[model samples]
Target: MAKTIFITGASRGFGKIWAEAFLKRGDKVVATARNTTSLNDLVEQYGDAILPLQLDVNDRAAGFAAVKQAQQKFGSIDVLINNAGYGLFGTIEETSEQEARDQIETNVFGLLWLTQAVLPVMRQQGHGHIIQISSVLGVATLPVLGVYNASKFAVEGLSETLAAEVAGFGIKVTLVEPNGFSTDWAGASAAQSQTMPEYDGVKAAFQAGLTDDSFGKPEATTPAILKLVDAENPPLRLFLGKVALPWVKQVYANRLATWEEWADVATAAHGH
Candidate 1:
């Protein structure tokens, strides 16, 4: 059965790869980017199977309009891939307030507004899947990328609540937490900050570890995503890349150990 998949940030990287994969599988795709011209290749190759739209996901109005256009063009939006987000690379002190807010505006808030716009269509149809592209740092912490981590953490929290609230309505929400991938995340697309000399050590370590082949390629991740979309009972959270599962497990272990060690303090705080 061919389903309609609506994807944001489809100009390049993960979004573009996913859009192409879906189209190849005979799915109708509503592919959106900040600049529609970037979708020309997809349009030329996929033809009518792909509807390319110009959209800045940060604007609520644009999100609504895009959803409306998808509905008009395809009759229903069966799946939504919230992939329009960027990372901000810097320590909190190195990052300006405006920079932090702009990061959130597109990453955290944009996902919400777009999901809000698409919720109605999914509700009316009584079935849909919302896939939020988060990151491994969403649950764990990394030095110098605090703001980016915060944004993805917000996505993590929001998607969990969305899934619980909409499960009764036959709607599903999945948060995709990916490890470092061979995308432009740390290169052209990431919003980099002025170097803070104090964080030089952290920066050096990160750069030294990130070899060319260290990052997972976009095509390698497509099969896992396809499986999720095809599953009858998809997970509420899906972590991509070989590095994600083990690292996240260690994070959870540390978190649980810390919480257990502080259980007495937490219970005492109740003052009962």
Candidate 2:
């Protein structure tokens, strides 16, 4: 049976690839991006199978409206892919207050609003899947990407809680942690705050590493995402890419070890 899927940020990157993969599998896809014009080629190519719409996830009303429109068009959304996030590369001090707020609004609050809008419908229908496009950075902290890391970390927390909350209602939430993939993600589309003078060297290195050649192909993640969509019992979290698994595993181990080592002091601080 072909399912109905609603995906955000479908103009490019993993969203675009996922949309194509679903369409190829004969599913109905309501694909949205901030600029619908960017999706003209896909609309022309896929016709009715892919319904392209203009959606700015940061706009709360628009988020609800998009969900309503998708429901009306496809009857019901069997899967919702919250893949509309961008990286904000900078040190904490380097990123402006507004820049940080914009990051949270787009990556965290926006996703939450969209999820909230869809949950009532999913709960009433008795079955649904929600996939959040997080990153390995969500599990581990790295230098110079604090804002992006924070956003993904929030996603990790939100998805985990949502999975537990919706499991009884026949809805499943999955978080996808992918390493750097070759997409327009690292280009001008990504938000990179101006570098603080003290961190010039690190900023240069970060920018150099993000250039086109350093990432894996976008297709690498599409198969895993599709599998999750059709899975009978999908995992709560999936680490995509060969490189991401080990990193996430190591981070988990390291976090546990650190917590254990600090347990005495941590307890002492609370006067326990």
Candidate 3:
């Protein structure tokens, strides 16, 4: 049976790859990007199996309109993939307030808008899946990418709650956490903030080390997404890539250690 899938940020990287993969599998895909023209090739190749639209995720109205259009064309959307987001790199002090807001706008609020826009339709249908393309940085953190990290962390928190909230309606929410890969994310899509001389060495070394960190192919993740779509019972969160598990585990261990160290004081404020 073929399902109708709607994906945001389909212009390139994982989004474009996944859209083509779904179409290849005989599924209907409503693929969207800020620049709709980028999807022209996919539409020309797949014809009716693919519907490409221009969507600026920061616009709530556009998100709603996109969902409405998908429903009108496909009857129902079995899956919604929120894959539109970018990375902002810089020291917190060096990043302007607007920069921080813009980072959150696309990476956090954009996701929220799209998710909210699709929720009603999914609920009405009684069964659907919402796949959130979060980052391993959401679980862990890096110095220069604080704002980006915060945005993904927000995705993690909201997705977990969303999964539990919609469980009764048969709406599944899964957060996909992937570590580094060969994607547009590290190229033109990424924003570099004004440099802070204090952090020059750190930034330079990080940039140099970036070359060897490719853990997997961004398109290879399409299989994982497909698996989740077909899963009768899916996990609330999935960590992808060779480094995802170890990196996440280390972050958890640090958290546990801190919590244990402060357990007595942390619990002292409240009296039973």
Candidate 4:
């Protein structure tokens, strides 16, 4: 059965890749981007299977309007993929207030607005899937990506809470945590803070850690995502690349050790 999927940030990267995949599979996709002109090729190729809408996800009112338009055209949105976010590259102290605010606005608030817009539509239909495009950094930290990490962490928390809140309505929420991908996310699409001399070494070390092998091909993810959405029961969180799980395991292990090491101190603070 073909589903009507609403995807944000469909102009490029994973969004564009996944949009085409869905369309090729005979599904209906309501694809959105900041500039509709960028979606012209997909619109021409896919014809009416794709509905190209110009949407800056940061605009709350526009998000709701887009949802309304999608609902009006497709009748029901079977899936809502929140993929409109960018990487903010900078250390904590080096990150400017405006940078932090813009990051949160696009990643956190933009997601919230769209999710809210779709909830009512989904609830009425009695079934829907919400896929949030988070990152591995949401669960663990990486140097020089403090603002980006924080934004994704917020997404993780919000989506998890939303999953619980909407399950009774037959709505499913899944957080798609992808590691490094061969996309413009860390390149052209990313926003960087002004360079600080003190954090140069940290930035260099971070850049050095990223090798060609670290990134997964964006096209390869289409099958995984298709299977995910079509499953009878989808996971609350899905890691897209090879590096995420093992790294997350180590992070959790370290967290567990630290908590255990401080268990006595925590118990003393409780003071029964």
Across 46-128, the per-residue lDDT of candidate 3 in tens digits comes to: 99888899989999998999999999999999999999999998988899999999999999999999999999999999999
Q: Model 3: runs farther than 4 Å from truth?
A: 208-214
RMSD to true structure for each model, in Å = 1.1, 2.0, 1.4, 0.7
What residue runs in model 2 are displaced by over 4 Å at the alpha carbon? 204-214, 267-272
TM-score of each: 0.97, 0.93, 0.96, 0.99
**Where's the lowest-lDDT run of ten residues in candidate 4?**
198-207
* Clashing pairs in model 3, backbone N/Cα/C closer than 3 A: none
Best by lDDT: 4
Error of 3 at 27 (Å): 0.5
Residue 263 displacement (Å), model 3: 2.0
Question: For candidate 1, lDDT tens digit of each residue in 153-173?
Answer: 899999999999999999999
lDDT of 2: 0.88
Give the TM-score ranking, best first.
Answer: 4, 1, 3, 2
Each model's lDDT comes to 0.92, 0.88, 0.91, 0.95
Q: Which is the winner by TM-score between candidate 1 and candidate 4?
A: 4
lDDT preference between candidates 1 and 2, better one: 1
